[model samples]
Target: MPATIPFKRSEMKRLAEFAKREGVRAEIEVNGFVFRVAPDFNPVRVAVTEESDLDHALAEFDRKHGYS
Candidate 1:
């Protein structure tokens, strides 16, 4: 059996914008199919060694979020 789902253009545009701003992927399920929108670039991986700014930032975030 096939299903039909109604999706609005404005809603799709908003979802794409949200995904871009958040630098993450967004997905929607339509009629048993999944559609995805993601930022069009590969993220650069930073090597965070001891005393690096990124390491410090991550440590701060973990502490703030009670993950430390």
Candidate 2:
């Protein structure tokens, strides 16, 4: 919930956890969506008032060309 910065390995891990607690979770990327791996854990469908998220951007070079 602050300024942006470079994506660090540690930050990614923590971000993933924070998302889990907030009831928004994902397994990995498939298309532009994060697919879920777990079966039991699920969140309710609702909107948020706060504004903060892990801005995960796709690799420019990879997107332009083909497979990464």
Candidate 3:
């Protein structure tokens, strides 16, 4: 299973704004770990596209993208 990283929407928005204004990716160090925030990343959405079978969709995507 893939690991998940959590970020607050407000924090992400602030980072996004900073990156956009500075024209660079925002970097932060927490503990011994470093993370670069994507300027174009957005987690908030008004609606989601429904999927009938997510497994099949992911399998197809992997097959097409050459992912194991």
TM-scores of the models, in the order given? 0.49, 0.28, 0.36
Ranking by lDDT: 1, 3, 2
User: What is each predicted model's overall lDDT from 0 to 1?
Assistant: 0.82, 0.52, 0.70
Q: Find the 10 residues in a row with the least total lDDT in model 2.
A: 49-58
Name model 2 segments beyond 4 Å from true. Answer: 1-6, 25-68
Q: Which candidate is the best by TM-score?
A: 1
Tens-digit lDDT track of model 2 for 1-68: 95443445575677577666776654555345443422347567544432222122345555677856
Query: Which of candidates 2 and 3 reaches a greater lDDT?
Result: 3
RMSD of 3: 12.7
Write candidate 1's Cα lDDT for 1-68 as tens digits.
76554577787889899999999999888777776899888777666664498788999999999995
Model 1 steric clash pairs: none
Better of 1 and 2 by lDDT: 1
How far residue 4's Cα lies from its native spot in candidate 3, in Å, is 6.8
Indicate the residue-level lDDT of 3 in model 2.
45
lDDT of 2 at 66: 89
